[model samples]
Target: MFKKLVVGTLATGIVLTGGIGSASASTEGVENTKQVAPIAQKIKLETNYSSTNNQYGFTYTWDSNRQVYKTYDFYRHDGVFASYFESEGIKWYFKGKVRDLPGGGALGHYEGKK
Candidate 1:
């Protein structure tokens, strides 16, 4: 009976320890997502017309201090639109669309991470 009690206690302790570790990992993941959301939200691109290709495109760079992305250039093209920028030893790229906004300006969507 004593041996059985010891084995059961050990098993329960192991399971509880694992559960605590998993909870901690989950919390860390949530915090990371929260941090990344703001960075991603700050990305913006300005629209430009390319007379050559007759398509619209945009270019931008990441501003770490201001937490905003600055547009550098834009052009029109076919196929997927892509642009590259480097910040703090990390290389990032933006890939998405450039479309006309009903009111006036142009809108772009790009995704990248550093």
Candidate 2:
């Protein structure tokens, strides 16, 4: 019957379109993983230093093999106030506040990728 044939054709179209959409989405995820994989897997801290005054300082370095740049900043009143890095078409950021404790100490909380 024409109705049966039409129903079958519509079902076939829907299935084909769904399959194509899923395939494309999977491919896109793979591409994104590849783009960010280098930085996520290979980045490492190279050097870190603090200021003599302890008010402000920073660590700077790069992953030579992966070509990722990284830096971490330190603050006397605010421990590890901010951090930033980028590589392989991806960028990462971290920021928080920390209070310097009494008697030359620090007390605070921070959260982010380090």
Candidate 3:
């Protein structure tokens, strides 16, 4: 048992030291490393469309106004409209608590609620 423990410790030390040394050595050319261009931001939506609302398309209903003009709004990250809604002219929009995606998975019914 003692021999095994010692061997294990030695192996771990060797691995750790090798990793650290290699990492340090790799930094030797840091000054000559090419500057990487900023990666384009990508938005990944786990789910799109509202199941309960039976709505399609990217737009959503902002408000219901007695069968008049329904208000609509859109959700955008960095000015890109990811989601939107349509409703009466009342101009409805998602609240602060609304989830980024539709359906009740993230925020439950609260996401569909006004």
Leading candidate by TM-score:
3
> How do the predictions measure up, each by TM-score?
0.22, 0.22, 0.24
lDDT of 2 at 50: 23
Among these predicted structures, which one has the highest lDDT?
Answer: 1
List the candidate 2 regions with Cα displacement exceeding 4 Å.
1-57, 80-92, 95-114
Which residue pairs show collisions in model 2?
none
lDDT ranking, high to low: 1, 2, 3
RMSD of 2: 13.9
- Whole-model lDDT per candidate: 0.50, 0.46, 0.41
Candidate 1 residue 76 Cα shift, in angstroms, is 3.9
Q: Model 2 — TM-score against the truth? A: 0.22
Clashes of 1: 2
lDDT of 1: 0.50
TM-score of candidate 3 against the unseen true structure: 0.24
Over the full model, what C-alpha lDDT does candidate 2 score relative to the true structure? Answer: 0.46
